[model samples]
Target: MRRALVLTDESARHPFRASLPPHVVRRANEVERMVPWRLKLGLTRKEAESVLATYAAGFVCTLAYFS
Candidate 1:
């Protein structure tokens, strides 16, 4: 994802490189790199997956509508 973002940034000026530093809220899963994050704050795997899934579905619907 990082690589893709870098490649996609058309401007020679790197915005993310200068400001908006990357912050890792929770380490992503090694096996499933697409997994968003795992909070140490104690959300179970099932609960987290459900939450992310809901957010993803909403986002997809929004994009589909706009597109």
Candidate 2:
């Protein structure tokens, strides 16, 4: 996703970028990459819910770091 962002300069110039520092965006991207995509496809409903919670927690933690 980092590579994609670099390739697409339009997105890089988004107004939100002014508020969210580059470091914060990079940290969030790293957290996103940590999610188990293949494993998620095979998970049961309950298991998927847990995984979603974990993903959300990671994103929250990343944002919390900026605070």
Candidate 3:
């Protein structure tokens, strides 16, 4: 059940191979690989949102630092 949901969500996000640039798609795949699969599957909606927000904030901070 969980696996099916995960697959469905992932497919929904990337409905086509060319939906994103090659580099962006590669980077996203890399980041997804780094995540603990179990943790990702187990996270509650709010917890998942918090984790995503944290990642977004860190990405913004890193961009700011380089710029």
Candidate 4:
């Protein structure tokens, strides 16, 4: 099964820049509406794959940063 969660740009961006010790993957997208994001961990690829599937569909991946 796939687990879907919301993530903020700051949290996701950190790993993208290699700021975080853990591995974080992100897909860039532009959304017409505003939706927040969050960070998550997976013990295995299957877990991560589930999250990715959800991230790909649930949220609009983007490079936009708001500090």
Candidate 5:
């Protein structure tokens, strides 16, 4: 986990991505609001992908979802 932190430290460059659970969920909500109703599924898709990536990278966020 410690190693992951160093790997995902690029968060500064990407505010949407953070190292906290609450922040991740918060960003997720923000992301949800950003997507249009017609593209609602995007959030679910991004959440699954981001959650997997987050765990893989050792962080706990998915700010990219809001993108």
Candidate 6:
């Protein structure tokens, strides 16, 4: 299970794609059960994907379901 932090226009940026914070990575990893509805994390699909890629390094996250 992947915990996608939904990105928004303001939160979207290229720098986030450079590196991923270990703490955040751990936090995302801890996410086991997914909620029924999407919870807003102040991010968008493109932005979330970029960050996940940066943190996981070659890791790909699907955006259909996110928190």
Candidate of highest TM-score: 1
TM-scores for every candidate against the unseen true structure: 0.41, 0.37, 0.40, 0.26, 0.23, 0.26
Q: What is the C-alpha lDDT profile of model 6 across 1-67, one tens digit per residue? A: 9976643333324466324555654565475777533254767678878887787753334342342
lDDT, model 4 = 0.50
**Which residue pairs come into collision in candidate 5?**
16-63
Candidate that scores best on lDDT: 2
Clashes of each: 0, 0, 0, 9, 1, 6
Instruction: Arrange candidates, best lDDT first.
Output: 2, 3, 1, 5, 6, 4
Model 3 Cα shift for residue 54 (angstroms): 0.2
Error of 6 at 22 (Å): 44
Candidate 1 wrongly placed segments (more than 4 Å): 1-39
Instruction: State how far residue 41 of model 5 sits from its true place (Å).
Output: 13
For model 3, give the RMSD to the true fold: 17.8
Residue 25 lDDT in model 3?
61
Candidate 4 residues lying further than 4 Å off, grouped into runs, are 1-42, 60-67
lDDT per prediction?
0.57, 0.69, 0.67, 0.50, 0.55, 0.55
For model 2, the stretches where C-alpha displacement exceeds 4 angstroms are 1-40
lDDT of candidate model 6 versus the reference = 0.55
Q: After superposition, how far is residue 51 of candidate 3 from its true place, in Å?
A: 0.4
Superpose all Cα atoms of candidate 6 onto the true structure and report the RMSD in Å to 1 decimal. Answer: 23.6
Over 1-67, each residue of candidate 1 has an lDDT whose tens digit, in order, gives: 3543322223325555333323421222135445544654568899888998999999999999999
> Could you give me the TM-score of model 2 versus the true structure?
0.37
Error of 3 at 2 (Å): 45
lDDT of 3 at 37: 64
Candidate 6's C-alpha runs over 4 A off are 1-39, 58-67
Task: Report the lDDT of model 6 for residue 4.
Answer: 65
